[model samples]
Target: MNKTIFITGTSSGIGQATAQYFEAQEWNVIATMRSPEKQNILKNSERMLVLKLDVEKPETFNEVIEKAIAHFGKIDVLLNNAGYGQHGLFEATTSEQIHRQFSVNLFGTMEITRALLPHFRAQKNGSIITITSGVGRVTVPLVSIYAASKFALEGFCESLSFELASQNIQVKIIEPGNIATNFEQTTKSNFAADEALTDYSDYLKKMDEVFKGIYSGGGSTAADVAATIFKAANDESNVLRYVVGSDLQPLIDIRNGGTDEQYMDVLRSTFVPEN
Candidate 1:
């Protein structure tokens, strides 16, 4: 029997790429998105099933999961990739934004995993792969809420891995650095700002420059993330974390090896140098 992987946020970016990658590898893919009608790509493939799934709404999960199972028999993997970045100063971020960030990035992922646990446990074999961020492991400027959500997800997955081990369910996290995708465009639109509080305008500008520098340097592509996710799903080893993007490894190493003060200084000097 061929393996089936149910992936969320498959409308575009890494999700879409992953769906394509898996289908090319002869795996059944349940590719889900918020607006399935608007999706033109990833259609007509016999092994691919594109469906509507809004991660923020838990009520929709049962129907989606049931349909996926009915179509593919049994899902061997669940890829939680449905999330957006909430970028801006923490002070400028509103309560609603914070809630929205957590709801999608953290709560939604957890709920989906919770709903699938019984099935996975019964099967005595499964893999839960989440697309976290480098920011989840190391902090950066101007995306505090987004980082918080990813951080929460990292902790949640790490803790849940221990509990799920007895059932033979593997929980894995993929931490990717800045990738060339529609993410930056979405983040720009979703970013919260307060013009009245112009005191932080200079800081925001500097952060923008830092972001521009990173993008201009040419980071990893969404396809690279898709490949990494594929490896995480298939690897039978006891590895828990797979860090994608060559640009992110150094920072992760620094965070692991350096003290808190040293890390802070590194971030400050790298992204917020004094003029």
Candidate 2:
């Protein structure tokens, strides 16, 4: 049987790469994005059904779910890959920015997963994979809001996996270190301000430089993450999480073994101090 996957945020970056990987492996992929008209790769793929999906809009979930079922008959996997980063000082970040982060990354994803639960329960088999981040486990300076949203996803998905154990619905989370993609460029920092707040502007610039270095140098590839997602989707035994990146394994191990301070030290060591 040809397994079907509904992936969000397929217009670019990791989501786009993952969609292409799955389709190439002969899976029926419902590649969704906020703008279907902008998706050349998805539009060109015979195995892909490109649809418009804005994760912040909960009302769009049912419509996309209906369309996906109509196109693929059944959804074997739900890849919740749609989210943006909110990077800046917590004091500078507005309530609106916080709300938008949670809306798209946490609440909206929960709504879609909830809607799909009945279908998974009926079929008695399904898999869910979410693209969380290394920040979910260890905090980094200037990205607390984004980290909080992913942290929530990690908790929610882990708990849901235990709840769904008997029902055969497997939930897995992929924690990828910064990757070389447009993902970093798309990050929005709430630190834009005039002379009154110019003191903090340098902080934003420094952080942006740090992000650029991370993505351009030490980060893993999107293709690597796509392969991990494919494994979690097809494997029969349920694995709760898969961490991607060369350095991620040691960090995860340290986090698992030692105190919070020990884990945070690893993060601090990576800090590129402003010159």
Candidate 3:
């Protein structure tokens, strides 16, 4: 029997690529997104099922999962990739923005995984892979809320891996650096900016410069991240974290090697030199 994978946020970027890659590999793919009608490519494959799934809405999870299982017989893996970045200064972010950020990035993933746990436990084998960011391991300016949400997810998955190991289920996190996608546009759209708040304007300008530098240096593509996700899903080892993109390795090493204060100092000097 062909293995089946259920992926969220399949409308574009890493999620869409992962769905296509797995489908090409002859695996059954439940490619879900908020608006499946807008997607045209994946539906061409008989093995691929495009469904509607708004990760921020927990009420819709059970129906989506049930439909997937009914269509594919069983789900061997769950890929949580349906999150958007909420970028801005922490003080500038409204309560609603913070809630929505955590809701989609952290809570939604948790709810979907929780919903699938019973099925995985009964089968005694499964993989849960989440698309976390490099910021999850090391934070930078302007993306405080986004980083916090990913950080929470990273910690959640790491600890959950231990509890789920006994059941032969694996929990893995894919930490990718900047990927070439509309992610930048999406982040900008969600960014909370206040022109009247002149106190932060200069700092925000420097932050934007730092972000531009990172992107200009170039990073991995969404396809590369998809490949990493595929590897994590298929590998039978107990590995819990997979870091993608070469650009992120140095930052990860710096964080791992230094204390919190040292890491903060490094970021300040690099991104906010005047501060």
TM-score of each: 0.97, 0.90, 0.96
TM-score for predicted model 1 compared with the true structure: 0.97
Error of 1 at 253 (Å): 0.8
Superposed Cα RMSD, model 2: 2.4
Candidate 2: misplaced stretches above 4 Å? 188-195, 198-213, 269-275
lDDT of 1 by residue, 163-275 (tens): 99999999999999989999999999978898888988888888788788888998999999999999999999999999988889998888889798888888889777687
Q: Please report, as a residue range, the 10-residue window in candidate 2 with the lowest summed lDDT.
A: 188-197
Of the two candidates 1 and 3, the one with more favorable lDDT, higher being better, is 1
Model 3 steric clash pairs: none
Q: How many Å off is the CA of 45 in candidate 2?
A: 5.0
Stretch of 10 with least lDDT, candidate 3: 37-46
Q: Which digits, one per residue and each the tens of the lDDT, describe model 2 over residues 96-189?
A: 8888889999997898889888989999989988989998986777888899999999999999999988898899999998687877657743
Clashing pairs in 1: none
- Provide the overall lDDT of each model, using Cα atoms, as 2-decimal numbers: 0.92, 0.84, 0.90
Q: Which candidate number would show the highest TM-score if scored against the true structure?
A: 1
Top-down lDDT ranking: 1, 3, 2
